[model samples]
Target: MLTLAISLLVAGAVSGILAGLFGIGGGAILVPVLVQALAIMEIDESIRMHLAIATSLGIVVPTSIRSFLAHRKHGAVDMALLKSWAFVLPLGAIFASAVAAVISGASLKWIFTGIATVVGIKMLLNRPGWIVASDLPAQPARSAYGLLIGFFSTLMGVGGGIMNNTFMMLHNQPIKRAVATSSGVGVLISIPAVIGLIVAGWQRPELPPLSLGYVNMMAVALIMPISILAAPVGARIAHAAPKRALEISFGIFLLVVAAQFGWTLLN
Candidate 1:
């Protein structure tokens, strides 16, 4: 028990730091790591992926709070934009959750694997250069963008950081504000996604220990606070780091994680 606690603590801390630095859910890092680590601990495979994704999301809630607060303190967020897009965020989550229920576990794996690979490849190519500032659309269009972001995010367990940030940056929203706003999206997306997981997995066959539906409460308990505590440190680093270097390095990080996930799926 002590060993498990310590392992989760380390994972949470690393995830939280990355979450803060990137203004994204650390799931891209946490999910694969937790999945493998949990397996090493002899966690059953029946619900392995579910636990990994759910616990990663659970950890993200607290981690995001810490990062969001830190970013808020810096006046990095665009509160007005958040207000405008907030409605679409939850709606998208609901849609995604509904979609998840219909898909089989095997199908979900393929979906996740595909998304991870595509997004990773996109990050590597550095394609989709900055969206034209002058082309920044009206309010309705921005809301549409939010809905799209939320949809993809709910399916993948990410906090919609890449989508939202990319959209905002294209429209001339400063990078700081874009990152800050993306943090807000995490809360919105997680609530519905978590609820959906519960609904989908309730009473299903074979779940591991300390699970709430698909979520592993033990993992959540162990990971949340550590992530929260480490986020401030990451936020400070993000604030100080050169933007281009940070983007490239993190892009590489995403690539590595994607490869890891693919390998897991294959093996």
Candidate 2:
């Protein structure tokens, strides 16, 4: 217990920094770390990923809000767009929770690994020319995009930031603004995702101590405060930093993580 707490503390600090730096909710760092930690705790492999994912979302609630406010003060967030997404994003997260209640843990792992691979590759490519659409489309269409963001993000245990960043950047949104906007997306997904996950995993057997469904409250308690505190530092750095190096670094990290997951799947 002591060792797990310490590990979670370190991960919280790192995740806080990354969240602020990259406009993420720190799920990229937290999810894998939690999975490994849970392994040490001898959690059942069948629900370990689900538990990690749910806990990550629970921890994200405050960090996402903190990051969003940090970016907002810089005037980088697209508020109008976030307002448009407000209703649908949570709806999607809720829907994903329902879906998760039925999916196998290994299936969830594959989905997360696949997404990490694509996102990692995209980051490494760093192509400014990869525009999928000329602009963010009108509503209903926009709502469709929000649904996807919430859906996949919830399933994968990420803040919707990554997908939001990719989608916006593809639509010609500037990287900084995209990052800021994605932070807001993070806020939208966090609470609902946590709730949905909890409901999905309610009364499951074999969860670790202090678990509320798939979400581990102990991990949340340990990770959240530090992550929240460190987020502002990251947000401050993000507005001024050269992103190419950061992108490459994060890309490599994701790909490495993906490779690990792939190996697990194969074995």
lDDT of 2 by residue, 1-267 (tens): 788888899889888877788778889889999999989989999999999999999988899999999999999999999999999999999999999889988888899899999999999997888887888889789999999999999999998888998999999888888989888899999889999888888988888889999999989998999999999988988987777888899889899999998999899
For each candidate in the order shown, give its overall lDDT on alpha carbons: 0.74, 0.90
Kindly give the number of clashing pairs for every candidate: 0, 1
Pairs that collide, model 2: 20-234
lDDT of 1: 0.74
Angstrom error at residue 176, model 1: 1.5
Kindly report which residue stretches of model 2 are placed more than 4 angstroms away from their true locations once superposed.
Answer: 1-3
The per-prediction CA RMSD against the true structure, in angstroms, equals 2.6, 1.2
**lDDT, model 1, position 105:** 48
Which pairs of residues have clashing backbones in candidate 1?
none
Q: Write the per-residue lDDT of candidate 1 for residues 1-267, one digit (tens) a residue.
A: 577667677878877887778788777777767777777877667566666776677777777777888989988888887788779988887787777666654455566667666656655554345557655577787788888887877677667776777777777776767777778878777777788777766776677767787777877887887788888888888788745666677677766766666676678
